[model samples]
Target: MGKIPTTIPRRQLGRRLRDMRQEAGISIQDAARLIERGAGTLQRLEKGEANRIRMLDIQALCQIYDRMDELPGLLELAKVAASKDGEQGLWWNEYSDAIRDDFELYVRLEASASKLTVYQSEIIPGLVQTADYARTLGARYFSDTSSREIEQVVTVRLNRQRIITRRRNPVEVDLLLDENALRRVVGGPKVMAAALRRLADLPANVTIRVLPFSAGFPLGVACGPFVVLDFDRATGEPPTVYVEGYRGNLYYDRAEAVAQYRDTFRTLQAVASSPADSKQMLRRLAREYER
Candidate 1:
């Protein structure tokens, strides 16, 4: 048996594919044989119960299910699922932290993504947060959580930051911050000041944009916080979108929602400051907050 992803993104993608198949009015047996797998196997995959997916098998299913349009999206999830090595359950899970649930798929997808576009409505994006700043915020928000565990989480987030420029394929990141992130006072003024300096000091490729309260909300704001990750086809040939929320994450392979979010993001981009101006704004906030 293969390992299952303990996170929402992986399962959600599989669920979307299954829904699309049923909507097309295809029977499970036809899909299974077409994908060159057993009926039960196809059924399991559709239910988000499958451990791993074979590439040729997915291609076969895509053809039979009459979803040549969606084959690529399923392929990307296959790549993500393959990278997962089941983690030993962490002690911090006693509080049932939401981030813990996302840890596995978060790493796998980040590793594979060619470009990551993020809109952070509150707090610094984890990729750019300073250790003390992270510790302070994590400690407070996770009030019941012990300092040791919080420290471990801070370490994990900081460690993940190194992926900004990995050797073989340097990941590209475009992070948009709400102005509050720079002014929220997570670790008090001093800690906030240091955090801003760290954000300014990041490597050149990582772009930080601040959406000031003055911008008065862009198209995407109505939907709430979401990160859209772009993975150029590696083994699977289609791009996939991951949307997260408090309840769970949603993966969109359906044409409609994907198109809608893309349009929404484009609207946000239109209202956002240009790259040069964004950097300057971040620098200004850092100085302003310092005083």
Candidate 2:
């Protein structure tokens, strides 16, 4: 078995470390000083970009944060992050070169999520996209790259859909697509028609609805694309909201922030067409595309 990416464990450890430091009201400089390390190093550790993590440093930080109760688990996570071997056979590793550094973390989180709630204003979400549709967007996004690289990117995306497509305990999906997504002629009308038909045929675990133009912005403001990832309690990871941007992505995990996004989703859901209606609408638009 090949070595798996330890990024997820590293990120989880980093989040816990940052949370503990904040909870204890310890400044990064102060904590770093006590740990006898540079502030930059501590920051990298908290960001999960640290290539090497020392058990002693983790213990000292735990002691300073008065979070000894969490020490054992933190140490275990640190060990895993620092180790060369991890779980085997994750497909993403095969296409690591195609994935952007910032987006890699989100992929890990998405794979681990028990449920996903998504909102897209202009384009179909990647998880639900057809191969040709994904390839079209991939080519545009990676215009400078070789065709092979673009294909790898598309493969990585299609692989991600497996989380929802797998037969055993597939992740539940609640996708809210703005009406504009349907009208957009991505990869031409033929591609759009095929994509919509696939969406209309999705399984029971996937609930897709369209927020029609008639709804006219239920929140009275345009909301960009975002995804909320809910994890199983056993993972000890908090629910996270991912906001993707042209330059960089943002993640919010604070309880209040997560709650606000949830409220926004519920509001949109109330106004969006019902799943049955949305399916009918999808088929209707698909037929139009066929014409």
Candidate 3:
């Protein structure tokens, strides 16, 4: 029918719909029957993978979920989700073939995040990484990946960085990095040095903290690299935790899971060097790399 929605808003609407259904104690099969759609179709809608969503279907589902009070906002979100594709398509959609579906979802959330709290144990966080640094790491780990594909990945990484630097209401970034991240030479000393210097030059809205080896593996050590994205409360979007692994990414929106990650982040912030101290550390590391 109309241009099927394929952006982040659609996915978010689906997630909200799913949450409403569960809160109403309705099963997927029951909900599907009420909407006169097959179980698979209903599942797709709830998962945000549906190409098209009829406004009438959304109204009916909201009624079934007894969420009439939220109808106005839900309708608005649906309309935005179904609008012309390219007009509002996410920037990362172009690199869809190069990244996993879960990563695509993560990119969507990252775009809308009002604030980002990240703890990176390995290399520099993507939000602050330089192009050379990103390409170096990508080429090393994904040696089998074609040069063109690696470039696409690097391009996407650079675009993601813009989220924090955009002029209008740039997302506030709080980064907690492990000391080892600074010492490891990702793209040789020159690239590593440049990256470290770049961190030192971040805008006032960005905060970087280095968790020294002396910190001795806090609770977050086992968690690996995870990001906690907080959205505008007015949007009714709950805080979310995104954990990345070798295979794919895992998303956690459940209150307990989100809280655990938040707590870990706070703890890490305490143990890591203060922002001022971290910047100085970065400068020193850059000099070391230069030498």
Best model per lDDT: 2
lDDT, each prediction: 0.68, 0.90, 0.84
Model 2 residue 176 CA deviation in Å: 0.4
33-144 in candidate 1: lDDT tens per residue? 6666788887767645566767777777677767888878778867765554443343223334435654445555665567777777777877778899889878876899
- Quick one: ranking by TM-score, best first? 2, 3, 1
**Per-residue C-alpha lDDT of model 2 across residues 157-238, encoded as one tens digit per residue:** 8998998989887899999999999998999999999999999999999999999999997898899999999987866678
- What RMSD does each model have against the real structure? 7.1, 2.6, 4.1
TM-score of 1: 0.69
Please state the error at residue 14 of candidate 1 in Å. Answer: 4.7
Q: How many residue pairs clash per model?
A: 2, 0, 0
Candidate 3 per-residue lDDT over residues 51-125, each given as its tens digit: 788899899998999899999998998888777753355666677876766677777777777899998998898
Model 2, residue 243: C-alpha shift (Å): 0.7
Using TM-score as the yardstick, the better of models 1 and 2 is 2
Q: How close is candidate 3 to the true structure, as a TM-score?
A: 0.84
